[model samples]
Target: MPCDACATAAGDPTGAEFLTTKSRLLRLLAPLLAAALVAACSTRAPLPAAPPAATPAPAPAPTGPLTGQPAPNKSRWVPVAWSELPGFDADALHEAWNAWLRSCERPAPAFVPLCGDVRRLSIASGEEQRAWMVERLQPYRVESLEGTSDGLLTGYFEPFLEAARQPGNGFDVPLYRPPADLTTRRPWYTRQQIDTLPEARAQLAGRAIAWVRDPVAALVLHIQGSGRLAVREADGSTRLVRVAFAGTNDQPYKSVGRWLLDQGLVRDATWPGISAWTQANPQRVQEMLWANPRYVFFREEPLDALDAAFGPRGAQGVPLTPGRSIAVDRLSIPYGTPVWLASSGPTAQLSRLVLAQDTGSAIVGAVRADYFTGWGEQAGDVAGRLKQNLRLWALWPK
Candidate 1:
């Protein structure tokens, strides 16, 4: 889990947790939907492991989650307040997106996510830059979801969540599950790019919660988020090092384990790396890397900077477990509320803590949140590299 960084000074930009199991949707998932829709993601790092369940929605509800005990009358959530929401800049966004697509055509760096087959992109309403998504995401079109919220995530919206869970299209691609699926194609991505971090590779490959469509995409996304970018320091937060990118916990924990080894903080306890090392270690591989809990993915600035000041770049620590380290909007799901999360998307290999902490950005709805990834290049590589489906549910209070 991320070290203690005061939760974005509550009310500034909201922070939320999506601690749900791998099952049907839950009340808690409603918040997740909101964040996915409106959260202005800066940069991110790698994700951690799964967590215990959280929430109070039964899937079989004939009508919906309503009719059950009434949840507290919390404040209504509004993504990017009318005032904060900047005018839609379709042109700018499109330009950047296409550039990203172009970048994919060439050989990517070691820690980037490949977009070899980014099929049609349909970033309808609720998406920040529709024009940008549309212009850059050519061939595909953008839809406006003005008066109606009926897609997969529609019902999860505040007013809608109370009535019943809507059966809208899940994630960005509804009627578009590729046959063979993207995860099955690793060759299309950049493999064995980080020759010096075999330990990190094995740790991440076996350690994270499998999510990337290809290794290249994962590496590209990670590198892009942190590499050669202007660092934006939070005001008066010089001591704090804001970690822009954290990778997705899309792979197995074993991958994470090897990463620790490459860092020289820990030995190859998992044996797989040792096994690989025995046959033939990758060139430029580091055998002196180390890792520890204190160096886990951190969200707070000072701590992230502190770790980066001494830790490895383009690498990350562990993530926050869902149920264990989550914080939520008391109004939406009580402080100790456990919820089930089920949104019809791919998989959401998130961070160690799916905190329901407050956020101060555009996504401050009762049903929204911010994901805190650790700082630096590694974090950026992972955070920017992820794009998948998610479903959440919070369990009842223990």
Candidate 2:
């Protein structure tokens, strides 16, 4: 006999009709089969019963916030009340509005709808903006899968260096653009190889965009990945341009600071410490620089009055807002996400909003971040010394 529930579930509507037909046929054959039924049952064996239906497995529980959204590939987002976010109410939202507005220029898919509200609130008061955030966003305490919340926070900045259009007059350290055959060469050339090898030199022969006087400063530019250059053109007039990261030689970034530490040459590996050592041992500067095999190429960009206000474009493809832009691991927290950062260390105490507008090779893990401190010497000073503990909260759409 057909199972009515199973038949209906399978979308076959003839189960009930088949049952009625079987009843009529049974009534018609009842008298004729009465005597033979007992004999037939005694002679024949019973048919095997149908196998039981398999049960479906249950779905896995959500690993993200209550909203049921999945966490980023490298981190989990545990939903928390806004009140739990330390100093959320105390932070001046207007200061971070510029970074939020910049994020709108290339908003992520999840944040696309919120950009309009973000723009409107740009002119609003801090208290009003805070209130708006409370209503529109959900705060998630960022953590690793192992439930670790504390992470390292470092800083980076744009350097300002003087350069020459041509290599002469003591401006001999060349910064190059990506070579024409850059793609053809896998892990093209190490920093030491590029400096000493003729074949490597030939590949980058005419690719120098500008040349600076100090090799140390050029190394700084390479590590920072970008900088502002006051370039002296062939006409002797100076023009300010930005050198942005183009490509690398595909070598690993072995830290010169780590090299110094491992060699027991210095206890401090900050830029200031490195500079002091380089000045003392000028002859060994090349040896110190070659400690790191990686090399970065750059492309020159025009720095107009409007562009001067912002830092060089970050990994997110947007101009970074100093003090308000942070580089995070894209696998942990995506670009363009607004974050509430809180840290208290020897260098500085920070409790404010920042946008995840950039990324760095070293800025990995669930809660790690590199804070952008803007440009020039002072900014560089802050960036060099900023290594501290950090905690982060991601403010996502409700």
Candidate 3:
């Protein structure tokens, strides 16, 4: 009996009406009602449970210049065991080449295969490469592939023909791999022998450097990107900039890691001694080795061979034969392509054709190379100890 007029005095009434009615009913019921109150008022439906935080992406595994799941058949392709030319005969290769050419109207796989090697046509001089360039361009087209196009077959080669000059290492050299082999069917350098190094010994801790630019794949781009390190200066500044490669205990390379190490100038460790160190520092190996260039392989013959677990280059069988790995210009040379190589000088040092089984990020152009470190710690140690001279040639039927 407080009245219907009191319902208007009760407030805005939607929710309040519920309260008022309950209060009135409770009053009428006297002390029988239990206590109650609006727990969560002003209302809308409770929010849907927030989706569980999305699972974090897994951290990528540690690797050097390789990414995703790897090539899948990465280990399946072994260096061409050309002792007796292995499985495919020269005739069989010819048939395959001819068949592909007939069907595709382009250079066959012999010209390129997954990680294969092709004979690099030797241009005696920049003049020669230029002459070929003219024929392709017709003087009217001042076309330059540099910084544009794949560059592997054209632009990348010009720099070598003009600058590096294969058989010409500074003064005169007979120690280039293909040159030595072409002249003698053996590499110019070998584990048992190193050719008459026309190039002088690495002065003090000096190393050499080369460039692989605007590569085709992001995998390579990421490596070159990461491989790059800023050279800091004293007083928190840096002056010079360079892309370095590992030098050979036998040759010269200048990767940032190598440059740092060379500046440190390690002299005591022979191949065997380095192996012991990698074993002890197994935990932070790449970090330890990256900080020290003495353990990064750029070129030169590895003391042992390649182990897939490590890098590339090594000896594999019981008969005591050489195992090898290399990187080549995928544009000029295809993967799985077999190459016959030769070098110069008096010794059968680096003279033999091996399968171009492996590839690397910075490894570009027809003349480029990366020797694999063999299996296990020894291979890793030996691979870390390379850097050398080079020459390249592709194998083909005369």
Candidate 4:
């Protein structure tokens, strides 16, 4: 979600101290704390059931040549022929080429001269384009400084949700735009402070862009950094808008998914697992959200059929291509560089060319990558379940 003016860095925060989860006692004492709290629990409806995990694509057999051996440095270039790239010949190169075009929109200087070549080959046959790539780029395998060639690959996507133009009925939680005085305060406010403190609430009071019924809806939007909102306009028509990353409160971004894992409440720390835990522990939803101190702010973007076809702009300032765009550690793979990704995850065996078009909070390490799984529920299922072994090859200027 680090796009245009938004730059998000990863942070690991210790979980907040948990108080008792005794709902019966809390309900009895609720009247005394009425000013600061609502009833501990009510009959809350569940969110839509998460889509089933995608069936893993069969692993393609490796027929390509291997590097002579691992590079000695944390990341080293091993001379690899184009034949060494698994599934290289089979991919829809035109699709990847589209991602490459977006990469060139704010391309690194090293790639500027090659932009024209990319455009010219956009209409070429896949093989011709593959040939063009082999002629122009050198492929180097990436690894850790320790010489470990393997790393992790996960997925992320743009989520869509129902929202309201005004807060009422069950849609009471607000999604806010950045406050005008945001810059004046350092580490402006924690999630708990924002929810409970008067001054902290005052800063964001008038900046809501939309509202949702469940706090988790807003939380997921915050985590994803961007999402499509189906807004119920005052006149009863629905208009879709995107909430792209605006800025953050400068506090550390924490993972509630990870928090759920450490508490042993869930075995797999995926979106579905998080949802299941939230469903069972509705009374503690506020505490679960407050586990992360960092908060996100967003601004609206147009979401037409065309815009919805692509994803939010990445760090490269271009809309991301699903399955062909990746967020990498720029120090290891410069922006706009093409990469040969070989991964065998729970959902698929992915071996293809991807553009280093973005970066993310959790995407660290030279070999680490977050695969853009695209938009919507099915993509989300793949993204949630995908944490697999990954190897990378940077296709750079020869």
Whole-model lDDT per candidate: 0.25, 0.72, 0.25, 0.68
Model 2 C-alpha RMSD to native: 30.7
Instruction: Tell me the deviation in Å of residue 244 in model 3.
Output: 25
Residues 228-256 of candidate 2: C-alpha lDDT, one tens digit per residue: 77778899766778998888888876667
Residue 80, candidate 4: how far off, in angstroms? 1.7
TM-score of 1: 0.23
lDDT tens readout by residue for model 1, 86-192: 12221123322322333233312310322432213313232444433222221101112232211111100000001101112232101111112224533221222
Using all chains and alpha carbons, the TM-scores for the candidates as numbered come to 0.23, 0.82, 0.26, 0.81
lDDT of 1: 0.25
How would you order the candidates by TM-score, starting with the best?
Answer: 2, 4, 3, 1
Question: Candidate 1 deviates by what RMSD?
Answer: 22.8
Worst 10 residues of 4 by lDDT: 38-47
Q: Give the range of the ten consecutive residues with the poorest summed lDDT in model 1.
A: 155-164
Q: For all the candidates, what are their Cα RMSDs to the real structure?
A: 22.8, 30.7, 33.2, 11.9
Task: Give per-residue CA lDDT, model 4, range 266-362, as digits (tens).
Answer: 7855555667677789997788889878888999997665566567898878888877888987666777788988887456777777898888767
